[model samples]
Each structure stands twice: as C-alpha cells, then as structure tokens.
Target: MKQQTKQEILYRFPDGFWWGSATSATQIEGAANEGGKGPNIWDYWYEKEPNRFFNGVGPSVTSDFYHRYKEDIALMKEIGHNSFRLSISWSRLIPGGIGDVNPTAVQFYNNVINELLENEIEPFVTLFHFDMPLAMQELGGWESRDVVDAYARYAKICFELFGDRVKKWFTHNEPIVPVEGGYLYDFHYPNIIDFQRAVQVAYHTIIAHAKAVQVFKQMNIPDGKIGIILNLTPSYPRSSHPADVKAAHIADLFFNRSFLDPAVKGEYPQDLVDLLREYGYLPVTKEGDQKLIKENTVDILGINYYQPRRVKTKEHLPNPEAPFMPDRFFDYYAMPGRKMNPHRGWEIYEKGIYDILMNVKENYGNIECFISENGMGVEGEERFRDEDGMIHDDYRIEFIREHLKWVHKAIQEGANVKGYHVWTFMDNWSWTNAYKNRYGLVAVDLENNRKRTIKKSGYWFKTLVENNGF
Candidate 1:
C-alpha cells in the first residue's frame, strides 16, 4: 500500500483576523480649509511657524485623501485589506470642536465609511488622534476641564453618527504623547516646560477617555466594542543589579502603569499617585473622578509597539536648576550591541512585541487586543526604485514578517491578539517629520501630482492577507 501523505501546516491566523493599516485624518486629509473644516492644532501651528517642520512642509501638503479617498479606498481593497483604522477629524465634523455638525463634513465621512463598507472593509474608528481643534486648544487644550467636557461631547457625536456602521471604536490614540510632546518636550504645539501642567493634562485626558467609554457603553450599540490605543514601551534594566532593576521598575510605573492600570484595571497605580503627590504635582480632580475612571474601562486594547525602553540607575544628580521631568527618575542607557534603525534612531527589537502581548496576557487578564501599528521608516526610498517604477522594500517585508512571527507565537500561547495593522497605509505627511521617513507600503509621489504606487512589500502583504498566513 502507498504511504499516506500528510498535509503541511501553514502559518495561518484565527478566523476573522483583521489585516489592515492605520492613518490619522490630519496626516492624510489635505483639505485644511475646505469642506467646512476649521483649523486643528497642526493647521494653526503651521500658520504660525512653518519653518519648524521638516523641509518646511506642513499638514496642508498631505496625500489629499479628502478629495482622492475613492481612489485610496480602491487601493486599500486592492491590497486585500479587510479592516482599517481611521480617525474622524473633530475640527472637520464639528468645526471648533464643539458646535453644530458641518453637513459637508458629515457627507464626506459618510461617503468614506460607506465606500469602505461597500468594499467589504471593516472600519476601526478612533475618536481622537492628537489633532484637537484649535478652538478647543484656545480654551486651554486638555489642561482645562472645559476642553475635557467638550471632548466628551465630540466623542458622543461620533458614536451617534458612526457607531451603527463602525463596530470597533477607540477613544484616544497614544494619550500620553500630547502630555510628553506639548508639555514636557518642545516638539508639538503650545510648547511648554511645566510638569504640573503635564500632570493635569494627562489626568484630564484620562477622564475624557473614561467619559467617552461610559457613553459608548450607555449607547448599547449592537456588535460594537470600545477601546483605546496605547504605545506601551516596555522598560528594561541594563543589568539585574538591585539598583538597575529598581530603576527599571520605577520607569515602568511612570511610563506604562500610569495609563495601563487606569485603562485596564480601572485604578491608578498607588505608587505613581504617591510620587506625584510627593512632588506636589498631583492634578486637580473632582469628587467623582475616581468613580468615573473605575467604572468605565475598555473592552479591548490597541497596542502600538515600535521600540523598547532600556534604562540604568542614574549616575549623577541633576543640576537642580533645570525643569523637572520623568527622566529625573532614571537615565536612558543605550543597550550595547542592540539592533538599531539608523533612519529613525530607534532600536529594532522584534521581541518587544511579544513581551508586550505576554504582559497583557499574564497581568492584564488577556483582554482582547491587536497590533495597531508596526513598520519601518526609510528616509531616502527613491534610490531603491527600479526601471519598472516600483520601489523594492524587502526590508519592510522582513521587518513585518519577523514581528508577525513573534505575534503568532504570542497568540498560540494565549495572548488574545486579534489582528495586525501596520502603522500606515500610505506615505502620508508625518507631524514634524513631514515625510522625512516613509513608513507606508504605498509610496506617495509628492513631485508627480501626488501619485500613489504600491511597493513590493504592498503586493507581498496582499498575498499574506489572501493566505491568512505566511
């Protein structure tokens, strides 16, 4: 008798796996003043000082998604995208962040959502993505409780308008970024160096997210789930020495647990609370703020893993004259012999993804989650294009494959990972980077009428989606 043949096992994912990419409205939509859209922080900042951006480029020079969304949606369908994550521009929908809805903006979003659905693409919508309306910022941004309540109203409008068709909703993306960027660092708008304001802004943002989640639950939309996207940077110590380990633990408490605990476990870390209080930097909170945060937790999570944080115990005391910040607690130590992305100045540690998912699984009750953002950025991609006019981006392909391999392993070990979405779908404008580093599978030809061309990795990703595996 002939020997029986065994079918080979392939790297297949779970049923209904989400294979898509993510983009923010300000980064892709270029109609800054059209469609009845008011200015966001980017718009207002660009108007004030355009030279701060890379190559003097601003958000107004994005990929023109506002007018070319149909073609863009076609490209997404061609790439075998089953889901996509997009943010509805608050300034566009309700100009100035809180007021009557702009009918033109409503029509545009309706068209985009309807087009995606018609093409069999599921929408994972985010209500806030770091582009708060200029009017709201004028009212003290996230630092003021007025802006917080206004954000809650904006979130409610999003649910009432788009919740019926969009099943997955996220309240905020990288909520801590604005705190660090605007208040601690000088990269974003309203650049300031005040730790107390940073603390207050961070607190109010958490409260706004909780209120949004509360409204999402109260709406009782069928087949819908709500969550937030967090860039959970895993902190590692240089060595197992007691001081180093303690430093790393404190780093974790400050960076990860500050938001992770409140978002998932419905309580802030007591150590962090005490630390803030000790410094007299505790944010102002109302009587029922704790109850609001405790009662309104997310149903899912979006983890945007790009890099890891390595630190060692501080070597020397600060000057005691500079502004106070989190770095005062620990020093960032560059790991010797670690892989690095020279273009982005970030360490390319693929195992970081697995570590994040494992942490979520073991400590955070294995809540439903997905890889919301992961990709490589190439600074000078034009040099790689061939005679056929297609850019060969095998490095990005390998980068994603290696990351997904770890993601697959974590899922098999019960990490509750639901999907993998790339950092972006196309080479749109970055905040200050201004396309200095392109991370998209599809290249946007800025010099040639903003033409879109799918790179080699884009086609390879299409196959990966079709096979549901490698």
Candidate 2:
C-alpha cells in the first residue's frame, strides 16, 4: 500500500503552527552606515575589497528594509505570516559590540518589532547571525573568552530590553559557517587558514551560545523559549560498504553533531572528542565550561535544511604536510542522476528533510523544532516575469511542494516538527554573491528604484498558509 491516506492528515499543520519566513539583519536591512549603525565585518570587508563580492555590489543598501520595514511587515500580514524570524546586528544594537546600547538602533528595532506585533505577527528574534562587529573581530572575534563574555552581556541586554514582547529567541544561526569560512575556507572576513584557530572559534561559539541561554533562563520571561538555529546537512554514504558508512559517520560528527549534540544533548559526541584529541586539535576549555553547556541545553531547536552531503571512503591519503580539513577522512561523492539546483550548485534531494527530522526524533529526544529555512535560489528570475509584472516561478513552487511532502511524511511518522519558514520573504543582498540569485516570493527590482512586486509563488504561499496545506 502507498499509505497515502494515512499521511494526508499530517499535511495540514496544527493550528498556530507558525507560518512565516526567516531573514537576517545584514541580508535585508540596508542603511548599513546610517541610523548610527557601526560597521560589521561585511561592511568592513566590502570596503577593503570591493572586487571580492559579486559584481562589486555590497550590503550598504539591501532592499532598504530599514526604511521600508512597515511596508514589508504589512506585506507579510497580507501573505498570512503569523510569525517571523529576524536577527539583531550586534554592531548596530551595541556599537562596538559592548558597553552602551545605541539609542537609535534601539528605536529602530522597537519600531520593527512593534510594527510586526501590530500586524498580528509574533516576532522571533535571533541574537547573532554572522555579522560580528569589526571591533569584536579586532578583539579576537569568537576565539577569545573576552568576546564570549561580551556576547553574554549583549544577550542579557537584549532580553531585558525586548523579552517582554518577543518570546522566541535564538542564540546563533548557522554557527559553523564562520568556522568553515573565516578560519578554514577563507570565504568570510579575517580569512585565515588555520585548523587550530578554527577549532577554537567553533568552541567559543558554543560557549557563547550557552552563555546566552543561561542568561535567558535567568530572566524568567513567561512562556519564553530559547534555542539555536543550525543548518543541519544530513550525511549519506555513497554505498553500503563499511568504509563508506564510517566515512559518512565522521562527516556527520564534524559537520552536524559538532553543534547539534552540544546544543540539544548538552555534550559533545564522544567520537568527535576522540578524533579531535587524537589530532591534538581539541579546543581549549575552562573549568565549569562542561557544566555550563550541560546545564543550558536549548528549550527548542531550529533546523535550516537546504541540502544533504554524500560522501565515501577517501580515494587517497591526505597529505600530512597540508593543513587539516574535514575531507581528510571522507571524499565527496557526486551521486549520479540526482537532482541539482544548477543556479546554486546544490543537490536537491527532498528526502533529506525527512531523514533529518527522523534523526532528530530518534536521536535528539524529539525536541520541539521547525523547518527554519528551506528555499530555492535561482538566477535570472526576472526572465520569468509575465505581462502583468508577476514572476511565474513554477519551478520554485514545485521545489517547495516536493520538500513539504517529505516534511508531511516525517510528521506522520512522529517527528516533533512544529512549523515551516522559508529562507526569505523578499529578494535581498546575499553576502558575497550580491544579487546573483533571487530566493524571494516578492521580487526586488534592484534597477527600478528598488521596486517590489509579488511573485507568483508569493500568492501561492498565502493560499498554502490559509489552507494549512497544498
């Protein structure tokens, strides 16, 4: 039997299942230098090397959200967004990432939050989203205990200021990206290829996350929930061979469990610890750090699933002379006949979503969770626009439908999944890629005075939210 009827009820999400999208401060809110905002790494990096970003376009004026948030929030209500997730820029909230809070930044965030509440959209706030203040970077970024302490203080300040209204909080989004990009791959600012430093950066990030959770608990905000947002990429083996399975397991340890285990289970995986210790790469830790992490496990989790990773046994031994990398233990396997997002160079395997939810259910205590981010980014989206000025993005609609089907299956099988939030509500600046790809339901016209038009997918989304299913 196909079991189709048994699973159909799961497709309709429970009432108050948090229908919305996710966005970050740097990605959407322009006015980078205005409104008394201090420079984050993105602002500083773009100034240092304009050529590094695609088409030399930076984040100084992304979608002008600072000026247009009211309009955006209204559009969000129109699209049936009962909830939304956005991040606070550390540099903007507290200039230099420490000490006195910026009054102007406070007013801006207050306005945004108030507007969302007025529109009946519950605000979900994140404390960090990869936009480290340049001042903090100079003070050793996440590698130093000082910065971690500063982050804790900042989190406390945020709670005291906004905790009364904003109940759902997240400490960090995709925390591993900085460890991989800035310290390992040289994709982010302060690009330095050093494994030991990367390990320390990753460790301190966990510490910072724990500290934030600790402070959030102390505040005792009624009905408040604190969590971390991790981009979990399921690791699959190329074959059933033992070696391939082992290789995939190691990849999972490094990429997924390194953060997931700590945030959810309150401890690091033993195999990950053993591997790091074997390589003399274990991060430096302080007394009580273990207790801190163990005691501050998150109240919820946010899973950002965009793709999966397929790996196999290494074909060749890594050069001992070369610096360490995760691939030293496994090699990427380009699965033949798999679907691909050619625009973003990512494989599209919808089953990965179900696999992730099931793992969380079986391994992570079935923690309350949601699909925090899942969307398709496409190049040349404007080419699909019709005579009515609406983008006919049927491909994106199908992409979302396929992914949601897997989510429905996961829920039917008893995953404690709560809701789904797309990557964004509108097209905005994406780090170094500039505007090369559009991942929004609402098209942003960068050339036509930054006009906004509802895409075909946007209307379809409103219907999905209204019906609570396709």
Candidate 3:
C-alpha cells in the first residue's frame, strides 16, 4: 500500500478580495490626436522637444488602447482580473479642461465601462493622472486658484457622467510627482527648480483633491468610493542614532506626511507646518481652504508602495545661496548589500508593503485601503521571449510573490488592506522613459504591429488570483 501524503497548506485571502491591475490614460491610450481630443501637456511637450522622451517616441501612438478597447477588455477577462483601474483624460473629456464636454470622449468612456461591467470586472476610475490640459497649464497651472476650480469642475463633470456605473473614483494619482517632476526636478514639462512654486503646486493639488472628494460626496453615487492614490515610500534611517532617526523623520514629514496627513487626517503635520513656516515656504491660501480640506477627507486610501527611502543626517550644511529643496534636511543613505531591481534602480524591499499597511492601521484610524500599484519593470524584456511567442518572465512572478506574502501578513495583523493591483496590465508607454522598461503582465510587440501576447507571469497571476494567494 502507498503511504498517505499530507495535503499542502495554502495562504488564502478573504472572500471577494479585489485582484486586478492599474493603468493611466496618458501612459496607455494611443490616438492622442484622434477622437477630437485636445493637446495635454504631454502632447505639447513631446512636440516641442522630441528628444526629451525615450528614443524620440511621443504619446501620439502608445498601446493603441483607444482603437482596441474591446480586444483589450477581452484580454483582461482572459487573465483573472476582477477589477481594473483606468483614468479619464481631462484633455479628452473637456478639450480645454474647463469648457463643454466632448460627446465623442463621453461615448468612448461609456462603452469601456459597460464592457468591463459585462465581463464581471469592476471599473476604478481616476480623474487625473499627471496629464494636465495644456490650456489649464497655460493659466499658470496649479499656481493659480482658477486652475483648481477648473479641476473641481472637471471632477464634477466626471462624477455626473460616469458615477452611475463607475463606483470607485480617485481624485489624483501620485499628486506629488508633478511637483517634483515639473517644478523641483525639471523632469516634466514646464520644468523649473523653484521650491516656492513646488510648494504652491503641492498645496493646490491637495485642495483640488479635496474639492473632487466634496463633489463626489454631493453626487452620492450608490456604493461610490472617492480617494487619492499616493506613492508612499517608507522612510528608513541608516541607523537608530538620534540624528539619523531625526533625519528620517524629517524626510517622512516632507514626502509621506505632506500628502498623507491632509488627505486622511484632514490636517497637515504640525512639524511639517512649523518647518515650512520657519523657512517661509507656506503656500498662498484663501480664507476657507482649510475648512474645505478638513471637511472633505478621503473615504479610502490607495497606497502605491515600490521601495523605502533610506536617509541619514546631512553630511554637510546647505549653502545659503543655493535654492531651497527637501534634501536640505536630510541626505540619502544607500544601504550596502541591499537587494535592488537594476532595471528600474528601485530597491526591492518586500517588507515595506507590510510596514506601510501597519502604519495606516495604527496611525490612520485603520481606514480601508489597498495596494493600488506594485510591480517590477524590466528593461529589454524582448530578450526573454521563447520560440512559442511567449515571454517567460519568472522574475516578475517572484517579485509579486514576495510582495503578496507581506500583504497577507499585514492582513493577518489586522490591517484593513482590501485589495492588491499590480502597476500595470500591459506594456505601455512610460513618460520620459517611454518603453525603456516594461512592467506589464501582457507584452505588446511593437515590431509585430503592436500585437498583444500574455506572458508566462500573466498565466501565473491568473492562478494566483484563482487561489487568492500563493
């Protein structure tokens, strides 16, 4: 007689857990010029400085999601996707960002939403994903209060149009990226290194977010949830020394708490406020902005964790004549022997996901949340393709598995993490970097007339979703 074998125990998730992927309009949607769409900052920037983008590739013809939504929706269902996050192009919806709605854009979005619902996949809609309408940008962008009001109008229009079918609405995605990219670091359009402008931009983004949330509440779509997606990088110190810890705390205040506090707690961190006050970097505010923000905090939080920020005390004092910047308070400390994702140069610290969720649980009233964006981007992914036209991406499987293990641990520890969505569903155009790094479960063959092929990891992910765990 054969010996009896033990059944393997599996890590299981709660019933009805969300399993899907996220994408942005500007990154995925091609046909940038068609459908009566107006130029956003990206289109304008790419036209002016073609070389600024990777390999001179612009946003005009990306993944061609515009012409192939039906096909893409079918592929989404082919995988184990129960939910998908996509953004409405403000430029496409309201060409000038503050005028009449484009009927063409309206019809396009409705069809996509209906398709997702028909396939049993929930649609998560985001209002803005760093694609500012060129007209709005011309009006001084976020520096001018008029643009904030414009954003509020745009958000309201979106709610009224799609709020009936789309239940999950997000005000902004990684609102800080614009401040750092466009203002502080000169990586985005209208690049400038003005810290004052960066502060103003950051402050206004929160206000705009709150205004959208307020509009969402007023509309009161049944089962609707409004929130913001923030890329929260846990700040870690080189050592537990007082100076190192203090430096890390300040780094957190600048990067994490700057947006997290106002969105969740309805107030800015006192230390952050005091530091800004000391430096006279406070943004211009109107009389009732505080009241508006305090009364309109988010209903849920979308935490996008990629890596941890390791900081140490500044090695040397800043030059008095130098422009103001966040690094004035702390210096980056790269830990030796740390694992890294060489393709993206991002540290692969899987436990950071658990740390972020635990922090939200302990400090942020245990509000409902989810892993909105987490994945690895590898360069030259074509080199890994096999004879069967499939890309055997085992590394992506390992990366996601490590992250999910920590997510499961967080759930066990009482963190109210509701779902986990990878960074993207298909290989799409990344801003500036274009397609230098691919972070998709499905590969797009640019040489093969933009054909779509699900990678090995996509099959693995489908099984993972079926099991709800590894």
TM-score of each: 0.98, 0.98, 0.98
Write model 3 residue lDDT over 1-470, tens digit each, in one string.
Answer: 12112233256777899999999999988889999999999999999999999899999989999989899989989889999999999999999988889999999999999999999999999899999999999998989899999999999999999988999989999988999999988899889899999999999999999999998898889999999999999999999999999999999998889999999999999999999999999999999999999999998999998899999999999999988999998999999999999999989999999999999999999999999999999999999999998999989989998899899999999999999999889999999999999999999988888999999889988877766776
Clash count, one per candidate: 0, 0, 0
**Which ten-residue region of model 2 has the weakest summed lDDT?**
1-10
Off by over 4 Å in 3: 1-9
RMSD of 3: 2.5
Model 2 C-alpha lDDT per residue in residues 207-313, reported as the tens digit of each score: 99999999999889999999999999999999999999999999999899999999999999999999999989999999999999999999999999999999999
Candidate lDDT scores, in order, read 0.92, 0.93, 0.92
- Give Cα distance to truth, residue 467, candidate 3, Å: 1.3
Off by over 4 Å in 2: 1-10
Clashing pairs in 3: none
How does model 1 fare in lDDT?
0.92
lDDT of 1 by residue, 150-190 (tens): 99999888899888899999999998889889999888888
